[model samples]
Target: MNISYKFFSSHVCRICHRSINWEPKSPVSIASASRLYSGSPSPKNSKSEDNRSKEKWWSISNEWKIITTIGIGIASWFVNAKQDRIHSRKQMKMNLVSSQLKELYGPLYGNRIVAETSYRAAMKEYGGLRNYLEQARKERDAEMIKRWRSYVWTVLYPLDEEAVDIICKHAHLIAEKDFPEEFDTFLKHIARMRFVMEQWKNEKGNLESTKEFTEDDFLEDTNSSGIGGSKSMINHLQLKCKHLRKQQQEYVEDISVDNLTLGMLNKIKI
Candidate 1:
């Protein structure tokens, strides 16, 4: 049972004027003495080193956390901005579709219906004149001459002009794809009607100027003059009005205002 003592003393060397370490002789074994004097760390120093290492690790972790947080924040901002833009564009498309529906149903469709009604009424009046003319011709009634002249001047001329103008003005609104067959037919008929009305207007002016406005000139079956017989012109107009009215009615019944929603527009694959 050898006892070990740690000799703790500081001595000065007179020759070198430096502090010297002195170890007193102990009964401890040489290995134990050597172990004590060796450069093994104390508990305090080890604890301090460990604390510094932990602090450095924590600093690096905090820097990474801050960088990750900034990255996430920027990414989130970009995602939200992209979502906002997409939503805005979708809303704009919806609004545009809604406006087109209103125009198609309310103004364009409504005006065309009105014009058709006017045309139908005018045709009916002309049909009455045709009946009157036929009966007068059969009966050799001279009263029809006065009535026919008055009818052509007052009712027929103005009505024809109005119908021609309405058809021509609103013809462009008819989407070719929407009513392909009817649209093409309508354009052709409108061209004919416009031509007929223009010729009648010009001829009437010339007739009035020359004092040659007579029933024989109007009722003649001749294509040389601008008026290719008034009866033929009136019959053609009546047929066109009937056909157009039927087409419009069919179109109105087929298409629905509800069908013009955003869902339907989305289906267009734009």
Candidate 2:
């Protein structure tokens, strides 16, 4: 069986849902049916009976075999064609799904998914594009994931570290500002309160980091270069990361479906 491809991606099967017809009947040739009994004894009656039996089996077998094979071929073709159609549909569906997911979650969600997917797919391709994979390779990846993930949703594509850091600054905004319920809308009020607690925990890290970099902390060091302050800054950053990780674990704990939040989550559009 042959399938038609969209030469320019415009092929549509308007008749895909049409029904198939059963076979048309045709009369059998008697002379052909009698030839199998040519060598029989009693020449007339025995030959006729023997020929009749052979012809019956042969006729039934051939008719069914031909019909079965044709039916099988058509069925196989239909199955294969349906699989291809489903795959194409999945491709389109994933594209839309990713976008809708991003849109509903906002740019942060889009950045996270695209950067993660592109990173994962690229890692499979050449063990990760840590640096550029040559000009051509970079272009190919950009184009492919573009078709795959809307080309990272911008020329900048993956948000830089600074951008991510900026986004991290917005927990208060997420808590205070309006958001669609889609962002964990099913979560209970207690869950939303827990989210708020998690937000406070994260902000606590930022505050601690800021505190560690105070002028007093710097002034205590006599060194002109303030190497003590530098090390303190590194330590502060590590503490912040550790705090963030702990908060994440706590957030996951709070949001477990087995135990849920009530009001805060009920407010969202999700």
Candidate 3:
């Protein structure tokens, strides 16, 4: 009897075969095995890792914090300095305006008082002269007429030129919005005062030149003549002046550095 036997072998891919053939390696020693399995480091390695983590980064952060604080302080200082400069400039402008106002005030109040007093005295002297002229005419005394005419010329005092000049020189400094009507009224009265003085001077010259004076000759310029008319004008002017003075004083007193700046800025805006 003859018997036949057969042998078979299994086959796999190269990469898969290699993977299946590979065996997991065991740690070299018990200590290494303990470290690998426990997921812990040796004492020496742990200390080294701790040292690496403790690098100078924390000190760098502290330095950066200090630098950031200094930068903020410097920026704040610059801002404050700019504000101070602006404030100083504003203060300087205010002082200049205030000085100009002071100069104007001195002459305005002082000279106005003098002009008012002089006008009142002139009015009184004019009445006296009119009475004396009537007496001289009735008695036919030429000497008495001459005396009264001289007294009339001597008694009338002209308004101060310096005061008018001061007002004109500094009128632009005043804000037009502040008491505009009163300001205009004052200026008109001042002009009228000058006109009245000119008229009186002309009349006085005529009285001096004529060899023989008569009532008709004295009242020749009927339209613009008469000391009585001048007195009425002066009285009206006095009322306007009194109101103007009160307004001006109040306006000047209310002025302050802040308000002045605001007013100027408002004008610029317009």
Best by lDDT: 3
Candidate 1's displacement at residue 218, Å, is 8.7
- Which candidate has the highest TM-score of all? 3
lDDT by residue (tens digit), candidate 1, 148-245: 44444565445545544544565544333354343345445544544443443334463132143344424422101122233333344445445555
Count clashing pairs, candidate 1: 0
lDDT of 3 by residue, 53-150 (tens): 77667778888998987787676566556655665665555554554446654455556666656655644754644564565567766666555444
Which of candidates 1 and 3 reaches a greater TM-score?
3
> Which model is ahead, 1 or 3, in terms of lDDT?
3
lDDT of each: 0.48, 0.40, 0.53
Which is the better candidate, 1 or 2, if ranked by lDDT?
1
Order candidates by TM-score, high to low.
Answer: 3, 1, 2
TM-score of each: 0.40, 0.24, 0.44
TM-score of 2: 0.24
Candidate 3, run of 10 with poorest lDDT: 1-10
State residue 10's C-alpha deviation in candidate 3, in Å: 58
Write down the TM-score for model 1.
0.40
